[model samples]
Target chain A: MAQQPSSDGTAGLRELGEFGLIDRITASVARTENGTVALGPGDDSAVVLAPDGRVVISTDVYVEGRHFRRDWSSAEDIGHRVAAAALADVSAMGAKPTALVVGLACPADTELSWLDGLTKGLADEAITAEAQIAGGDVSRADVVFISVTALGDLAGLPAVTRSGAAPGGVVAIAGTVGNAAAGLAILSRGFRSGKAYIDAHRRPQPPYAEGPRAAEAGALAMCDVSDGLLQDLGHIAAASGVLIDIDGSAFEIEPRMAEIASALGQDPRAWVYGGGDDHALVAAYPDRSHVPEGWRVIGSVWPVPDGGEPAVTIDGEHPEISGGWGHFAG
Target chain B: MAQQPSSDGTAGLRELGEFGLIDRITASVARTENGTVALGPGDDSAVVLAPDGRVVISTDVYVEGRHFRRDWSSAEDIGHRVAAAALADVSAMGAKPTALVVGLACPADTELSWLDGLTKGLADEAITAEAQIAGGDVSRADVVFISVTALGDLAGLPAVTRSGAAPGGVVAIAGTVGNAAAGLAILSRGFRSGKAYIDAHRRPQPPYAEGPRAAEAGALAMCDVSDGLLQDLGHIAAASGVLIDIDGSAFEIEPRMAEIASALGQDPRAWVYGGGDDHALVAAYPDRSHVPEGWRVIGSVWPVPDGGEPAVTIDGEHPEISGGWGHFAG
Candidate 1:
C-alpha cells in the first residue's frame, strides 16, 4: 500500500492529480447496502433506496485549522472525526445510518496519499455504522474542508425528538460523555501523550446502533453529546417543557477520563458537565429499564413548576463550565 | 422581512449566534417531498426515498476567493450557484433531484443576515427543483466555504451513461449553452456591467426537468454541459468508444457571445467549445424526433474507425478552444 505523504512536501494538488487521488481513495471502499444503492460512487451521481419509504439526512463540515489541526491529528484521524460528527447527528435522530456523501477541499499543496488515508478512515467508520460511502466531491481551496452528509432509515419508529421528553422521565446516557472534552483538555494541557486521548479526538466511537434501539425502547427525548451533556440536555429541557436534574454522584469517570482529570488537576465534573465532541448519546426514557445498551441511569426529568425557565441542575446546584465551544470567542 | 446586511454589520455570525442563524435560514422553506422523504430537516438527520432501490449522489465545494469572490457575488447568489453545479451532476445521470444538504464555513466577521440570505438562495433553488433542503452543518473558518451534495432518484432508468453512446446516433442538446461562458468573458474582460453578467455568474438556470425527459426519450448517452459542449461531449465520446462530430451550423450562440468575442478579439468558439457552467443537457439519441423539449440537434455519434481514439471533431476537423477549466491548474 502506498502510504499517505506528509503535507510538508512541496507537491501541490495538481502535482498529486485529482482523478488519480480519487481512484486511490475509492479503491479501498466496498459497496454493500442491500441493493438500495443502485449506483455507488464514481458516477455523476449515486442512487440508493428509501426502502422504508423515508430517508434521514444530516450534513457537517470540518475545516483544517478550525475543526482539526494537522499538527495535532493525522489525516486518517481527521477523516474519522469528521465522519463521527456527521454520523452522531444521524444517531441523535433515532435513525439507522445508511449512507454518507463527503466533499473534500484542499490547498493545491495537499498530497494524494493524505487524501487516500482520509478516505480509508472515512470508509472504515461508514462500514462500522453499517453504512456505505455513496459519493463525494473534491476541489481546490486554501485549506482542507471536509463536508459529510449522513443518510439514515427510521425503520418505522416515530422519531424521538428533543421536544418529546415529559416530566418524570429518567435521564440517562448510552455512551461516554465528556471523553472528547477530557481528551481536548489533555491535549491542551500538554500533560501526557496517550492513545486514549488521541483516539478520543481522532475517532469517537459513538454507539452507532443505540439510537434506533433507544427510540424503540421509548426514549421520550434525546440528543448526542456534541455540545456538552448539560448544554445539550438543556436544549431538550427547553424544547420539552421540563427540567433535567443530573445526579452528580452518579457520574463515574472512566480510566481515560480520570487520567485527564488528574493530569490537569481539575475535577472530572467540569468535563462531564461541559465538555463537547464525545458524541455520546444522552436520552430520556419513560422508564429507566427501557433504556437499551445498559446505559447508566443519571437523573430524572422534572416539570418547571408554574412557568419557570427550563434548566439543568446538577444535584440541586448549577455546575459551572461556561459556554460550550464558542466559535469565535477568544 | 429584514434585508440581509453586509458582512460588516453588527449582528454577525459569531454575535447573533449559531442556532439563531439556523432558525432564520430554515424558516419558510418547504420540506415536503414525494412522500419519499422519511424525515425532514430540524433533527440530527433527514431521510428520503430512493424508489428505484438505489440512490444517486454527487457533491461539490466552492470557496471564497477561489470559486467566487465575496466582493463580487452576493451570499444568496453563491448559494444558488453551488446548488446549480451539484444539480447538474444529477441531471447528467438522467435522474430527478430529491434533496440537497449544504455545509457552510464562514468567518466570524460574516454577517448573520448574509448567511440567512445565502440560505434563502439555497432554499429557493431547492424549491425550484422540488427537492428539500434537508440539513446542514456550519463552522467558523477564515474563508467562506460552501459544500453541497445533491441526492437524486433514478426511477428505474438504466443510467444513461457517457460511455453508452453508439455509432450513428444523433447528438442533441436541451437548453442554452455558451451563455454562461459568454457571461464569464464579459465579467473577466469588464465588458457588461450589470444584472445580465452578474446573474450569469450568480445563478445558472439549467433545464432541470429535461433530464428525465431525455432519459424517457431513449437518449443512449447523456451528460450536462458543465465543462463546455465539446469538452463535455468529448467525455461522452471517450467513454462510449465512439467519435463525436459537431457541425458549427447546428450551434446557436446568443448575441452577447459575438459581442464578447469581438471585445476580446478571441473566437466565440472558446465559449461554445470550452466554456462551463451552462448546465445544458447533451445526449445522443437514435432518432431525432425523440429529442425532448427545448433540445436541438447539433451533432452525431460515429464508431471509431479501426480502433482509433474516440474523439471529438468539429466540421470534419479537430478544432481547439481554450482548454476546459482545471481545478488545480492555477
Candidate 2:
C-alpha cells in the first residue's frame, strides 16, 4: 500500500499514482444534499435509490482542445461546464438530476491541484443541481477527456421527448440563447472583453428545474439547445415529422449583443441561430397559453408538406446559414 | 442534413458526419433481454426502470494506446473488453446489470467501418450480459476514448461491499485468475501461438451469475479482479480490517499457461499473483463449507495483529511480487 504525502508539495499525478490520487480525490468528495445516494464513491459500485422506480440517464463527453481549451478555461470551469451539460440532458428529458458519474482521462503528469479544482467544480455544480457525485473512474491519457453520466429521477412524470411535437405546437426556450456561441467567437478571435459571453461559454447555467415544470405544463416535446437553436430545432422537426417555422424577431437582440456584433463585424443573428452549448431547454407546447413561466415562444410547428423535408425556417423563409457544431464535419 | 450513402464504399466519419454516423450505429442496437430498459436510445435521455427502487452504478474509461493498442485488438475486441469490464463491476456488487451508456471520443477521420465494428461489439456484449445499450454521446478527439457507465438492479438483495469480511471468513475466487496478465505478457513478447492467452487479454469473460449466488449464500465481501489478485485483495483486506493469507498452490495454473510462461522465460506465479484485467470475482465467505459452486477457496481471512497494517500474505509469508497495472505508474 502507498501512503499519502504529508506535505502539500507540487507533486504530479505520476508521483501519486492512480490509487493514491483516487484516495486523495475520494477523501475530498463533499457530502451532498442529495439523499438518494445510498452509497457514494467506494466499493465495486455505488448504490443510488431511485425513488420513482425509474432512472433517466444521459451522458456527454468533453475533450481538451476540442470542446474546450485549457488556455481559455480553467479546470474548474471545464468541470462545471461538463456537469451542467450532462445535467441539462436530464432536464431536457423533464427529469431532476439525482447523481452523476464522471470518467476522467488525463496525462500522467497532470497536476494534482488541477484535479482537485476539477473535482471541486463537479461537486459545486452537483450541489447546485441538488445532486451527488456518485462514482467515477480515472485513467491516463494524452489529453484531458471528461465523460459525465448523469442519472435523474422522473418523479412520476412522463419523459418529454423530441418525437412528441404536434403540428399545432409552439416552440419555446427556458434559458438564454446564443450567449455561449458568442463567447466562443469572442475567445477565438482574441477579444478580451465581453465578460458575459465569455462567462456563458465557460460556465453555462442551464435551467435545471424548468424542465419538469415544462413537462408538467404539458410540453409536447423538449430538448436542450446544445447544437444551436436552428440545428436542435431541426432535430425536433425531423423526429416529430413537423416543419418548425421560427419568428426571428422573437429573439430580441439586446444593445450589448448588437454592440459586440458591431465591434466583431459579425451578425448577432448568426450567433442566435447557429450558436451552441447554451444548454437551454427548448420545448414545444400545444399553444402559447400552456407554455410555462420563464419560457418564451420562438416558433410554431406545422405538418410537413407532402414530399417535403422536415425543416426549420426563419420567418417562414429558409435561412442561408445551416448546420451547427457537427463533430465530424469540418 | 447529410444523407447516408447507399453504397458502402470508402466513406469515413468525416464524410458521413456525426448525426449520420449515429443513425447508422444506432440502427444496429439489438433488443436487450433485461426488461428494465423502458426507453433505449434516440431520445434526450434513456429511461430505465429500477424495479427494486435502487440502482447500482459503475463507470470505467478505456483510452487508446494506454489501455489497449489498435494493433493488438480489433474494434470488436475493444468494445467487448470495455463492456465486459464495466458489467463485471456491477456483478461484483451482487446486482444484475440492466443497461450501459457509452461515451465515445474519436478522431473525425476515423473510418466508418471501424465505428460500425465497435458498435456491433458493444451490442453483442450487451446481449451477453442481458443488458441494453441505453444511450451514448459521441464527440471528436485526437485519439479514441471510450467511457462505459453500467447500471444494475440489486433485485432486493443487499449490496456486497468490500468492508464486510469477518476474521474467520475464507477468501475465494469465482473466475479464472492470471490469464489476462499472461496473455498480455505473451502479446508483449510477440508470441502469436498463445491464442487463448492473447484472446483473454483482449476480451475477459467474467462469471456474472456467480456474483448474486455468492451474495445469496452469505458472502461477506467481494470485488472484481481488475487490478490483479494481490492488489485487489489488498483492497478488501484493508477495507475489512483483516489480513488475508493465500494458498498459492490452490491456483491451478493450466499446462498451457506454464508452456507460455516457459516460452516467454517468465515466472507464471508472478502473473497469477500480480496480473490484472481478468475481471474475475473475488469474495470472502464465512467458511469453505458454505462456498458456492464454481467458487474455489484460495485463502482465509484473519484479524489484523495489533498495531499492524491489514495485509495479504501468500502461504503464510509475504510475497515478493507487488503492484499491478497502476495507470499512471511506470
Candidate 3:
C-alpha cells in the first residue's frame, strides 16, 4: 500500500473529492474588475456581462510526459507553460489577455504542495500577462494533465489576421526566436535544467504588448511563433496567398542561445529555423515602418508566382531541417 | 514489429510529431465566425475581440480511467461529458455560454474515428448550448485526457451566490439526482453500457436554462448538484451560515431511477443523498414567491441554534450515509 495520511496530510484531494476540491478552490477566488464576470465560480455556470456582445477566446493543453516530464521540470514549470501557451492565443489576436480558466487532473497520490506550486506558477504568469485565474476544475487521474483557456479584450481594435498581409509588407519579429528550441534540446540531452533554457521551456514569455502595438502600428498580419519560425511563417504565407522569403543572414542571434547549440552538438541554425515554443511576435509591416523595440526585420512577403506553390523559403532555398512539433504524428 | 507502418498500420503520434499533427488538424477545419476570431490557429496564440471589457470563464477535465473508459464510453460520450460540465459552469453563473476551447491529449495509437466521434459530440453539445468551438491545442500522451474551458455572457444579472440564502428561504431543485450514481454502479458491476444509465453517465443534460432563469426569478443562492444532494446543499448552508433541513418526503421519484436502483440492489436514497455528477440545479429562494416551472421544493433554510452545528439534516435526522465524494481520503 502507498504511504498513509497522517494529521499532516489532513484532508487531501481525495478527501475533498472532485466536487469538494472545486468547492475549496473556488472558495477564495473572486473577480476584481471585468464587469463581464457577473457571476463568478461556485455555480452551474459563471455569468459574464458581454457588453459589446462578442468575446474572444483560446485554449491549450500540457501533458505531463509529452509536454514536460515531472522528473526534469518542476510543477511550477508546468504551470507557467500551460498559462503562457493559453495567454499567447489572446496575444496573437492583438488583444490583451483578461482572464484564464484552468483544468487540472493528477494522480490521487499527488502532493498538495505540487498543486499549490502549479497554481502559483499560473498566478505569476497571469500577473505577467495582465490576466486572472477565474475558475477551473480539478480531478483525480493516473497522470497529471493541465488545460488552460485564456480570454482577451480587443479594446475595439480591428484584429490583424494572417491572411491580411500584402505582397509588399516586411516580415518582422519582436521576441526571442530560438531560445525554447535550444532549451528543449538542452533538456532532451540529459542535461540539468539550466536556468536560462529551462525558463524558456517552462515559461515562454511572449511579447504580449507587441501584438496590440503592432496592430496599432498598422501591421497587416500577425502571429505568435509556437511552431518553428519557418513553419509558422509558412502558415501566414499560405493563408495570405503569397510567398514569404526569409534572409538567413538577417536573423538576430541571442548570445546565450549558442551555448545550447554547443551542448547539443547541433547547429544553432536548426533551432532558429525549426525550433518553436518561443512565442515570438511575427508581423507583416507595410512600407517597413518604424520597427518597435525588440523587433527586427527578418524577411519580406512576396506575391505568389503564377500557378506556383505558396511556400516559405529561406535564403532562396527550403532548409532541410524538421519544421517543429506535431501532436498526432507518432 | 507488432504492427509496423509499412504493414498498412498508421504511424504513432511520436512518429508524426506535434507540429505535423497540428498542421493536419488545422488544415481542413473551417472557421465559422471569422469576425469573432481575431486570430485563427497556427500561432503561439489566437486572439479575439472582447468588446465588453468583461469575461466569464470556467474549465473542467475528463480523464480516461477516472472520468470515462474506452470500454464503457465512445469518444463522443467523453466529449459530450466535457462539454456539458464546462457549459454547466457558465449556466450556473446565470450566463449564456458563448464559446469553448478544448485541449486534447491522447495516445498515439488512438484511432482517427474516435477523435472524430469526440469532436462531433462536443459540437453537438455546443449547438445545444448555442456556443461555438473557438480553438484548441492537441498533444500526445499515454492516456487520453480532455480539458475544456467555456466562456459566457451574463447580460448584467447580479450573481446568485452560495452565501446569499437566508433563513426561511425555500430550497428547490430543477432536475433529477442519483441517476449517475446508479449508472456508475452498473458500470462498476461489469454490466455493459446501457442506453438508459449509460446515457446518464455519458451526457448529463442539466437544465441549463434554470440557472439564469433562477437568477431572473430572484434566487438568493444557487449551485449545480455535482455532488450528492445533501452534500452540495450543505455547501450552500455552510456558505450562507444557515441550517438546512431536507423534507425527504418531497423528492419526486423517477421510475427509471428506481428501476436502476433495484437492479443494483442498492438504496436509491444513498444515490440521492450521497451520489454525484447529476449536474442538476439546486437553489434557495426567498419566500418561494413565483418559483420557476420544473423546480420542486425539497427543503427549507433555518437559523442555526446558538452553539449548534450548521449542517444538513434529512427529516430532522442525520442520515447514516456519509455526505459525498472526497478526492484524497486514505
Candidate 4:
C-alpha cells in the first residue's frame, strides 16, 4: 500500500520509489564473471547455463517477525541467513549452487541503507558459495519478507534423495547442531551473550562443500538440519522405510553450548536434538569407514521392525522430547 | 506473529498446524507428467532437466492488500495472477516456461480451504502454460504474501534482450492493453460490471505462445507490458538507443474498455497508454511485414535524436499523460 510522504524530511523508500531502489540495489550487487550465467540481471529473465543439463532448485521464505526480528538481527544477518538456508537445500541434494533469485517485500518507510546492507549480505553469501545473484523483484508489504530461489548444478551426479538410505547405513553429520537454538533461547530470555552461539543464530554457515563430498563418498541419503537433527533424520527414515538410531554418547557437546545451557538452567542435549536452523548436513553411508573426513558418525540406520513405524531413536530408546520448529505450532 | 486459536472453531490454519496445512495444500496441487521436471515436490529441492543446457529464470512477489486486496480478488484469482505475472517474464525472453516454485507466507488464522483454492489456481495456471509445479516453501507471516520463481526453456533460440532494437525496427504488440486499468477504475467506483475488463484485472492470460513465435519471426527486442506501454517501451528505447513512436490510430480499443471509460467520463486512450498488468508482449521487428499474425503493428522505432533524450512519442508528439504503475509512487 502507498504511504503518506514523510513529513519529517527523512529519505524513505517512498521518496526513492521502486525503480530507483531497484537501480541502486542492482548496481551495488557484485557480479562475478561466471560462465554459468549466460545473461545476468537487467533483463526480464536471466539465462543460466546448466552445464550438466540439469538444475537443482529450491525456495525458502523468511518473514520479519516469524523467522527473524529486526530488533534482534541486522539486515545483513537476515540476508545472509536466508541465502545460506536456501543454498543449503541445494547442497543437501548434492548440487553445486549456481545462482539465486531473490524476492523481497518491505514497508514503504524502509530505509535505502537497509536495502543496501541486505543486498551486500546476499552478495556476500552468494560469493562464499560461489553463486551469483541472478535477479530479483521488490514489492511493498507491511513488514519485510524475503523469498529466495536457489539454482544449483548437479555436476552429473545423481541427486541424493531422502529415500535412498538403506537399513545398514551409518548416519553422520557435518557442522554444529544446537548452537543456533541455544542462541535463540538466550535472545528470547532478554539476555545478551557475546558468544559464538549468538552469532550462529544471527548467521548460519552451512557445510556447503561437504554435501557433494559425501555424495562422492557414496552417501545413500542426505539432508540439512533445518528442522533439528532428530526431525530431519526422521524424514529420511520415513522415506527410506528404516529406523535411525542416534548414539547419545557419540555427540560431544560444544563448550559454548554447555555454558549457555548451564546459565539458562537447561540441558544442551535438547538443543542438539530439537533445535532447528543450524543448516548442518546429515548423511547416511553404507559403511562407517567410507564416511567423509569432516563428517562425524553419530548414528546408524536399521530396518523397520515388521509393522512398526519407521522412527528416530536416541540411545536405543524413544526420547521424551517434542518435535522441532513448526511455524503454526509455535 | 502467531494468532490465538480460533474460539469459533472454524478450522483455521493454526488448528491445522504448519505440517498438516502443508500436506493439505501440497496434495491438492495437480502434477503433470512433464519430462522437464525430473523430480517434483516433497524433496528438499526439485531437480529439473534443462535439456537445452540453459534455463531462463525470473521471480516476482505479491503482497496482500498491496498487490491484491482480498476484498477485490479471491484467493484463486490471486494465485493465478501471480503465476501469470512471473511466467510472462520468461515468455518475454522468448522462452517456454517449464516450472514454477512458489513461496507463501500467511497469518496463522488463514483458512485451509482458501489454501486449497490457491494451490488449485497455481496448478491451473502452470498446466495452462505447460509448466510443472516443481516445489515450494511455506511460512507464517502477519499477512498473506506470495513469491513465485518461474523457470523456462529457450528451445535453442538466442534470448531476445531489450537492447537489441535498431532504428529501422517496427514496434508491435500482442494481446490487449488498458482493459485491466479500466477494470480497476470501474471497480474502484464500487461498480461490478462482470465484464471481460473486470475479469482481465482479476486474472490476466498472457500470450505465452506468441513470445517464441515472435523470436522465430526475427524480433529484435521484446518485453512484457507490466508497467504500461510507454514506461516499458521507454526501458527498451533507453537501452537500445532508439526512440519509439506510436500511431494512436492503429490501436483498436475494445468496446468494453470504451464503455467503462465512458461511464466514468474518462478517455480510454489514457488507459491504453498508461495501464499496467495487462502483460502484453511488445516487440521490435526489423520490418512491419515480419510481425507475427497475432501481433498488431502499433509503432516504429527511430534512431535517438542527437543529444536528445530517448523517449516514447504518440503520433509524432509527446503525450501529456502520466506514466504507468510504480510500487512506491502509488
C-alpha lDDT (0 to 100) for residue B178 of candidate 1: 67
Query: What total of clashing residue pairs does each candidate reach?
Result: 18, 0, 40, 0
TM-score of 1: 0.92
State TM-scores per candidate.
0.92, 0.97, 0.89, 0.96
Model 1 CAPRI rating: medium
What lDDT score belongs to each candidate, Candidate 1 first?
0.76, 0.88, 0.73, 0.86
List the lowest-lDDT window of 10 residues for candidate 2 chain A: A1-10
Question: How much is the lDDT of residue B9 in candidate 4?
Answer: 38
- Sorted on lDDT, best first, the list reads 2, 4, 1, 3
Task: Supply the TM-score of chain A against the true chain A for every candidate structure.
Answer: 0.91, 0.96, 0.90, 0.94
Off by over 4 Å in 1: A1-11, A30-36, A254-259, B1-10, B28-38, B49-53, B193-198, B252-255
lDDT of 4 by residue, B166-282 (tens): 998899999888888887887888898847878888889899999989989999999999988888888899889899999989876777667778888888887888887789999
Candidate 1: Cα lDDT at A125: 83
If candidate 4 were superposed on the true structure by all CA atoms, what would the RMSD be? 3.2
Better of 3 and 4 by DockQ: 4
Residue lDDT tens for model 3, B1-330: 012222222445455455555544454333334344445565545543444344557777878876788988787877778888788777776666667777888888877557666777887787777776677788777888888877665656666668888998889989878777777788888876445766787787878788789888889888778768888888888889999888988874577667767777877788777776778888898977747887889999899989987788888887787757555454
Candidates' interface RMSDs, in order?
A: 3.5, 1.0, 4.5, 2.5
What is the lDDT, from 0 to 100, of the residue A49 in candidate 4? 85
**Candidate 4 chain A: worst 10 consecutive residues by lDDT?**
A1-10
